[model samples]
Target: MPEKVTVSVTDEAVGRIDEVVAALEHGGMHVDQVLRPIGLITGSIDTQRVQALGDVAGVAAVERQRTVQLPPPDSDVQ
Candidate 1:
């Protein structure tokens, strides 16, 4: 079975992330290996309407996080 997902990104600046590495960029020197990226944001998403999101603009150089399923409270019992 395929996993169901609803992902979307808003073309807006929310905030910047901390940096942890130094690297050269085409434009100039940047904190290349940024632990996180700048201007990461989120908004409403509909997996069914993915086709309509082709024109959505995503932030630059930021990595998007994926949904993860955590074990139930009692799962620590194994």
Candidate 2:
């Protein structure tokens, strides 16, 4: 399964986000969004490939995306 992830670009790499994105893609990431101002790249990749993303030159961190589900407004659990 493809796991969604958030890749944080190193401070030194923020100016070269495009290159970072390219490297990530080369590392098997399916690019989704490039939040340049924040130096973050969001994407999905095979779970096994996630560790490879962290080894990319410009990557400072790679974290799997997590989701939180909430019940309806009327639900007892708030």
Candidate 3:
């Protein structure tokens, strides 16, 4: 299954985010957003390819996106 992930670019690579995005795509990442100001790239990729994303140049870290579910406003679990 494809899992969403947030890729953090290294400080030194902030200016070259575009290149990093290209490399990530080449590595099987289906990019959704490129937050240039924060040097973060959000996207989804096969679980198997996550490790490869970490190896891409300029990538500081690769973290899986976590999902949180909430009950309705009137729910007892509130």
Candidate that scores best on lDDT = 3
TM-score of candidate 2 on Cα atoms, chains taken together: 0.88
lDDT of 3 by residue, 1-78 (tens): 999999999999999999999999999999999999999999999998898999999999999999998888998983
Candidate 1, 4-46: lDDT as tens digits: 2222223242232221111112112222222234432223233
Estimated TM-score per prediction? Answer: 0.29, 0.88, 0.89
What TM-score does candidate 3 get on C-alpha atoms? 0.89
lDDT of 1 at 57: 37
Expressed as tens digits, the lDDT of each residue in 8-37 for candidate 2 is 999999999999999899888999999999
Error of 1 at 49 (Å): 2.3
What is the total number of backbone clashes in candidate 2?
0
Q: Which ten residues in a row have the lowest lDDT in candidate 2?
A: 69-78
- What are the per-model C-alpha RMSD values against the true structure? 13.2, 1.6, 1.5
* Candidate 3 local distance difference test against the native: 0.97
lDDT of each: 0.31, 0.94, 0.97
